[model samples]
Target: MKALALVAALLLGTAAAGRPPEIALTFDDLPSHGPLPPGETRLSVIDGLVAALKAAHVQHVWGFVNGRGLAREAGTAGVLEKWRAASFPLGNHGWNHSDLDKVGAPSFLDEIDFNTPILTGQMAGQDWHWFRFPYLHEGSDPAQRRAVRDGLATRGYRIAGVTMSFGDFMWNDAYARCAASGNDAAIRQLEQTYLTAATEAARASRHAAQGAMGRDIPYILLMHVGAFDARMLPRLLAQYRREGFRFVTLEQAARDPFYAADVDPRLGAAPTLEARLKDAGGKPLEIPSYSEMLGAICR
Candidate 1:
């Protein structure tokens, strides 16, 4: 009995010392599917996607549910309550999913205004400080980024950008085309593209720091909350795990200075999300539609 107890204690100690998860799963457009084209078959897909996340124990999700969409699909009261119930972190996508830069500051601020009431009213005075620029375009001008930053400052919003990149769009296309073309075409494409994106992102970040990209940098991976993305979650996680990455949430991953451009640990300016996006060719992926230049995002 004494020998057995000693062995059990050693095993427990080894298990307790295992590394914590390091990858952050950030989902955009909470429950926002593409255009509702008639026969409602996607509702289940959405549910399945959410179920997968829940099953994987993914607690924090950055849901970008537009107010209008909430009223239309998941009813504002119910969606708000459900998200809050899940303890999922919420952020404003925009008023109506419109482009912030094109509309200018007045209209942009209006977008913030449009949702503030709902958040304050339904969530009971919940303050949302994180803002995702529509289409991930901070602004057309450096001043515009500053202006949007100032707007967030006026209302206490945090400007978020992305760190690691992926062809999440292509993941879906591959599945669809593979089904059409037969075989595990989507899976194969996903395997190829997924590895490419991950490797390339690592390379880009390393190059960006001029040779500091390692396991230490907190990586913010961008993923849409679409069915296909959710479907590919397991395999994606496995791939990253093999590459020696652990799963974390946006709040934790965004803490790294590489992803957060200006978080001064001294004076305490929480690092904002700012990273240079690169295409598969290792060139800069332009805004308005990145990683989609090869029609990877669209079917």
Candidate 2:
């Protein structure tokens, strides 16, 4: 019996070694996701998120800051400091989380420039030069996209791209709504839905990469900082682990060949991988829109 158990363990280890997905964990809207519940403090939410990350043994994660979000909540500026103190890297999410598609190219560039001082102070000389588009909306037109891209290039900023996200932003808000109304049943459903969506999203990302590039490149997963996210993180990390993911830093994820695609400096941007695939004339994986996903919860 003991011999059989030893053989099984060996087989399990070998299987685990066969296919391990690499992903970088990234959070947006640092210091706050939206508004906090009446009694729960932002500090506590940050503490919970930090604790969960530590428990999951995630060494290096990235959090992008919306300077405007920080400014809205008094005494919440320390959230970024806490994230840095906890050893996570910080990036700019624009001053107001403005949409580049709706906002003109010049306005977008100004927002990026505007957030620098705040991020610089929060980073304290650390390398904090990455920028994530507020809504993943690169630009409405090619010229605008190129303009912003060129602007960021001159500013020493690398645009952070997301390859995996379950629209946890929508889930978070729905979860909050349910919680406020004390809808325990819906809250439970939300938790399960969130995890299931994450699992499926991981699969879709792998398929997208394989279909588009014939290989699975390291993926960047986008999430947010919120009370529900803090609560869900420990489980989310475990879910990723079970799905064969090894957490990586944003910098590390960028090292993949997929991230090495040359900038076309063209108009009409898509997801990083999708744009690359489309440029190569390969078929990109199709996933549901955010509104489609949100409708599942709301309806």
Candidate 3:
């Protein structure tokens, strides 16, 4: 998909149905530092992100580690330490950021296994049960989903699911350009674009509530701990807070029954945490892709 189109698609998917103090922030690629310090690139995004969370007094964050980078990157260890000390949750993103669905269950699970030790070693006391599927895309298959889950279970990892995400990666990038342009119009345009998406997403959930599900549960806001988020987070959080929404972690939100019970019979993804309720021969309708079955959002 084209970049703008792709960005819009991401915004719509996570916004499908929700409202309120329910939100979770997650970063993909830990230590998203650039080449290294003294080098201009120097994981600027990560540094910004960490500072934003610290200032916000955020207690729990899901850091998706890039195993290889952990060993090579200079500041990666330091970043991990700060997170560990603060007791934020750490998740495995794979030995590298390999796409789980594309890799097939075998290699996919292996990447996860290889990465776990490094993540555990860095994280120490906390549990590394959750995982964020790279690209937020996993192959749409039931068996593969099961394999991924079993692999995690074997190594004490759980598949993490996100219910809400802002295309913050894109949002931040766009804003960054506007700032550089030094144009007043660009700044207004940037804010207008994102604010509209955020509002629409919340509205979508509320509309779904009056029509279908009585209420939308906690919304998991996915963001990368890169150049964009660190700067965007404080503003995003403040914006949401004013909008009357609070923050949450993936663990807290996934624990909700509706989100857990969403089973796509085709690609099981992972078994629903609400297994008992899921049993007794009634599964929610296997709807088509949220993108396909439904028409283009933000079109």
Candidate 4:
């Protein structure tokens, strides 16, 4: 009996060690993102995205909105309506997707304020107090960062921190260019490179998390609602599955201690993996850029 108990314990430990990592998917620049391809409308792009998410069983994706898009593009408001109809939550990106480092705190806060009504109406009493910084620029200096952080907290908003991204948005315009010219070969190349980048980024992010925090916390992956992303999401989700990542909600991911500050706005600034790596005197991972190749190929 003692030998059997020991064997069971060892098996359980091994299973626990082999558990997959968790990641939450969040899309920025809702309503519109990047250049639309030749045959795609904004609604069509969103419909495709919603279908892909549903097919992957990814419930509770958060779509961050920039209110200015609704006002600028006719019929774009329906994109948010369709997103809500799918039962996904919406958060504020900003009124105009302004950069805090360039726009200053006062203007940035006003941008947040301008975006509030749209979110309030769209959310309809659901919790919509999450804010994803435009371009992921918190601020240029400590004082500026503090001012914006304080402003967000005062407005009852918690910051959304990004731990993983593969520059998915960069592929959209290139895809559009290729599609316009009916360049099937170039499009195939783009698809291959896109997946390669995403795979490498996942590996690098895991390494960074282990090196910085000494363990893997649940990761929040940043993505954009661009045309190419909608086209490739089915395969991307499959790739993550193959790499042993389980999809989670943003709130669920935030429950990890690494996201404590992000979960509670009143806490101090969240510690990023990059900052942690710098403090530990470790070098950052150098993920290769496909921007030049992406640009030159399709054009």
Query: Which has the greatest TM-score?
Result: 4
Candidate 2 per-residue C-alpha lDDT over 72-164 given as tens digits, one digit per residue, 9 for 90 to 100: 778888788788899888888898888887789899889888888887887788888888988888866877788888787777777788898
Candidate 3 Cα RMSD (Å): 8.2
lDDT of 2 at 193: 67
Model 4 per-residue lDDT tens digits across residues 1-299:
34323433443343358667789999999899999989899999999999999999999999999999998888899999999999999999988999888899999999999988988898899999999999988877888888888888888888888999999999999999999999999999889888878777776777778788877778899999999999999998987776668899999988888887876666768668888877878777787899888879766
Taking the candidates one at a time, how many backbone clashes does each contain?
Answer: 8, 1, 10, 0
Which stretches of candidate 4 lie above 4 Å from their native place? 1-17
Ten residues in sequence with the least summed lDDT for candidate 4: 3-12
TM-score of each: 0.68, 0.85, 0.70, 0.92
| Cα lDDT for residue 162, candidate 2 | 86
Q: Per-model C-alpha lDDT, please? A: 0.55, 0.76, 0.59, 0.86
RMSD in angstroms between candidate 4 and the native structure over all alpha carbons: 6.8
Model number with the top lDDT: 4
By TM-score, the candidates rank as: 4, 2, 3, 1
Clash pairs, model 3 backbone: 17-205, 18-205, 21-246, 33-43, 34-42, 34-43, 45-226, 45-227, 101-139, 129-158
TM-score of 3: 0.70
Query: For model 3, what is the alpha-carbon lDDT of residue 222?
Result: 64
Q: How much is 172 displaced in model 1, in angstroms?
A: 3.8
